[model samples]
Target: MSQPIALSSEVPATCRACNVRHAGMCAVLTAAELATMARSARRTQHAPGEPLVVEDSKLTSYANVTDGVVKLSRVLRNGRQQVVGLQFAPDLLGRLFGRENLVNVEAASEVDLCRIPKDVLEQLVATNPVLKQRLLDQSLQDLDEARDWMVTLGRKDARQRVASLLLLVARRCGAPGIDDPDRVVFDLPLTRSDMADFLGLTIETVSRQISRLRHEGVVQVANHRHVVIPSLPRLETLAG
Candidate 1:
């Protein structure tokens, strides 16, 4: 007798192929639930610097980052913007069950997203305990990262701060693991200006630090945006 097909196999073709579906919050979803979600989830793309959410906007939908990076920023009272966070693929893109968005979300790189209606997602969350836990887990994980970054900003020197950011992007944005390869090459997700904003450095400072890293042979750049980490461990030591 033939074995029964796996439930994951029954997930819609589009969803079955999605990396996000296999990890993050979506991992809790059963095949039928994924099908229902996929029926309403719209795939969308954005170029670098495109805005995805405005601060204080009505929350009518939620998104899953299927590819590329997102920037989370907020406007200060003085009219300057501060980048508070970055989100990567397979991550949920906004606050859960919130009535209004608290921060602005923008594409940090060419991005692909799967958008689900707010009502639909909320309803699913209400019914699925596992899904709710998954969402909460991700939220808590983000909070932990934020706290760690506070230390990076407050205690670390400029070079360390920059290395921390590079290590962060490489780890989150699909670079090879240390166990798999000593080297990692990826498109740098944030521009120098954006990195300066995120890291609390001036653009020139950010440039100098990157150049310093290149000089040290810790990292290499090509065509401006591609970052090649010849040794992730060496970079991680600097991040500390």
Candidate 2:
């Protein structure tokens, strides 16, 4: 507790899991079981724009974010890309099931993560019913998010998409609901380009849409970070 944690360029062969921030995922571990997990985790860092995993890369480990943001994107053969997901603080990274990578992972900002060997996690899950149940619950939540994103990508227009994304960020940051009947200011954590990708719009289009919102008195965009929703219900309807 006396020293600051350092990020590593690569996962050290011998690392301790006691350093992880979100060890509650392993809360059911017995003292001995916890010690085993601690021995298998390594701290790693990725600088902004660095690739953590590319399409089709072999999956060898799972990770939990300690700091910054990471993006999960898919690149098409024609060089187009879509950001499918973004990981913020305490979010998990990497796919399980030993499949080759289905998306590319990159640090959207300078990032820190706790890298856990897949084998260790699997062993823990096999012997520990509580850990297994926790993983399943987390997986179910992720599946729900995937379904929502599918709707965003397949059905929602740009305006709706942006609205939905903003709603999501607001909720993640502690907004009760899209329509809480209360006016409040929430800050946007993503860049223009990141917002565009998440909403499937060009940067210019995103800029224009935001301007339109401001002009319409629907929202107030100040200093490129804060969003003041004048009418939460109206914003929710427009976001659809």
Best by lDDT: 1
Residue 180 CA displacement from its true place in model 1, Å = 5.6
lDDT (tens digit, per residue) of candidate 2 on 68-169: 668888988899888888766566676656667788989877788878888887787787677677667777877898899899889988777887877666
* lDDT at residue 163 of model 1 (Cα atoms): 96
* Model 2 segments more than 4 A misplaced: 1-24, 27-31, 174-189, 216-223, 226-237
Alpha-carbon TM-score of each model against the true structure = 0.93, 0.76
- Tell me, by TM-score, which candidate is best: 1
Candidates in order have lDDT scores of 0.88, 0.72
In candidate 2, which residue pairs get closer than 3 Å at backbone N, Cα or C atoms, i.e. clash? 17-38, 160-239
For residues 1-240, what per-residue lDDT tens digits would candidate 1 score against the true structure?
222333865879998888777787677787777888888999999999999999999989999999999999999999998999999988887778889999999999999999999988998989888888888888998999999999999999999999999999988874775666878889998888898999999999999999999999999999879999989889999999
